[model samples]
Target: MSFTVLMYHEFRKRGDIDATSPSTISVEQQYQDALPKVLFSYIDDFKEQMMYLKTEGYHTLTLQEIKDFYEKGTQFPEKSVLLTIDDAFQSVYQYAYPILKELQFHAVSFVVLGWLSNEREYFDPSISKVMSKQELEEMLDVVELGNHTTHLHKRYPDGTSEMQATSLQELKKDLAECGEYVTYPDVFAYPFGIYAPKDIERLAETGIKYAFTTVPGVNTASTSVLELHRDTVTLGCTLENFKTIVEKGASK
Candidate 1:
């Protein structure tokens, strides 16, 4: 069987949802899909999953480590799982980062530079605040940072994919900005989990060694290096569901 690579998004503590916060208010108003139930995760659930991995004897691997196994025949420890989070949510520092450090596991965050802010980059009052520079510097102890593009996470009104919207120039430029901002490995987790075949060519031109997608499956040596799949952990995921994701993926 192949090893797993888990994907996660924003996280919120079970007891700490401030109903009156601008970020909360903004989602409560404009974006129906922004409900906390689906968009953010409970901190307790994250802890329990990590605990399961520990007690069950899973080895946490970074994307690079996994890549080595796939591309160069390097061997990883048994029950290897690569953990990744996208969107650079500030909640990661408060929730996932501490738990990962405490558990002595490693994770990677694919940061969308557009999401950073003094408070946050989006919303009227900027609600969904991403990690600050100081906090990110500290979080490096537990997490690696990768590119998630600068501003391609958002969708156009016509609903065309951002990477496919232009003549490949804008796509390269967006990735360039990400390279300039997010420093570390030359990995990329596609924004919006959407891409075209041409996008693969574009990625190579920009020094991207690996890319992640929203697809579900355990990655083996046969899996494509640029379009590797990941198991998504969401707010609704129970331990059983999480286990299935780690084992069988979202669909059988």
Candidate 2:
């Protein structure tokens, strides 16, 4: 069966959405010149999106169901979606978790295990911060953890990812280290939506069944699970545009 995978990163309150400084300017931009188009979404918008899914009878797929869809060729609901929040940001635990738990919707948070703190850090609404291990644990009810990488969420001076610059062995070690915290050992999201062909080819050796990219499209049975597509949901997206993106590429 086919489904849309919605990718999210940072979250902020609707009041924080300043017309002058958009939500698109994330903390990552200080280090990197370019960031993903879908970086952050308004917390209210996020809530509205989740409510829409609930009211519209959208089925949120579990990680196991997603694996079965590719491995066993199993069928899933036509209006199915997989919610993935990257970076395991504290905002997700503070905001998204409550909305999701209230709706009983399932989601996956791809975490950079090395970045996860042992205790809650100082809150700065201007910047998205990584969640503490305790906060992450509290989110287990509605969020399944996935691997983003251990400490490879960053890039080198030349913009080459640590994942890309390192040897395959190093990459495996990083993934394995992150896997220790991930709820699903077989699922990963590429850091900064960047990956080489070799990452896909060798990831299966590390027990990863699927690796999601930042590419936008609806994923079908014919799609490669290794480089599955995900539509980035950003603050710039209108609710109408969101509807279109979610339903885009589905078979009529």
Candidate 3:
């Protein structure tokens, strides 16, 4: 059976930004400029999308379920979808976690270990603060952590990701380092959805079993676990658009 995977990043809540201080004013300005960007989704819109999934009988697949689908040739319902949030943003813990918890939906949060802040803040748009380890721990009931890498979640001046620019050995080391902070290290979403064919061939050496990309499509038992596709849900994704995305690649 085929199933779709959805990707998300930072979330924003209206009226939640208190632009009182100079830092906050700058934060508010940055947020306003980023509103139309693909990576930022309004929290209310995100909630509506999750609600749609629940009402439409979409089952949020877990890590083990994905492993079975890849390794054991298992089949799951067509309505099954995997929800993933990248970057481990504090906004995810702030805005997305509550909605997922309330809906009893499970999601995977891919984190860059090097970027996690030691301190937690209620809101900080300027830094777009990463969640602290404490915040991540508290969401264990509804969120599973995945490795996005340790310090390689960046792009070079030439537009290649650090993942693409570095050698496989270095990449392996980074992945292992990130594993120390997370419960699951076998799954990864490519930094900037970047990788080379040789990189994929050697990913097994790093112990990554399943890897996701920005490429949009659905996955089936026959699909390669290392090259999984995901539909990125973004700022302007309407409810109708969401339905079309989730329904587009279902098995007949």
> Best-fitting candidate, measured by TM-score?
2
Q: For candidate 1, give the lDDT.
A: 0.72
- In candidate 2, residue 240 scores what lDDT? 83
Better of 1 and 2 by TM-score: 2
Worst 10-residue lDDT window for candidate 3 reads 24-33
At residue 94, what lDDT does model 1 achieve? 71
Give the Cα lDDT of each candidate.
0.72, 0.80, 0.80
Per-residue CA lDDT of model 3 for 1-252, tens digit only, reads: 888899998787755443332221112111211222467777888999998889988889998888987778777777888999987778888889999999999999998888776667676765466777788889999999898989887766576777877788898899999988776898989988888787788787889999999899988877888899999886767999999999876667
lDDT of 2 by residue, 1-252 (tens): 578999998777867645355332233213333333348788888888888888888888898998887878788777888999998777888788999999999999998887787777765666656778898988898889998888677776665677777777887898888888789867989888887788788777777888999999888888988899999997766778888877764334
Candidate 1, residues 23-87, lDDT tens digits: the string is 43222112212324455567888899999988877888876676577667887776778898877
**Total backbone collisions, model 3:** 0
Please state every model's RMSD to the true fold in angstroms. 4.8, 3.0, 4.7
List the lowest-lDDT window of 10 residues for candidate 1: 24-33
Best by lDDT: 3
The candidate, 1 or 3, that scores higher on TM-score is: 3
Task: Name the lDDT of candidate 3.
Answer: 0.80
Q: Give every collision pair in model 1.
A: none
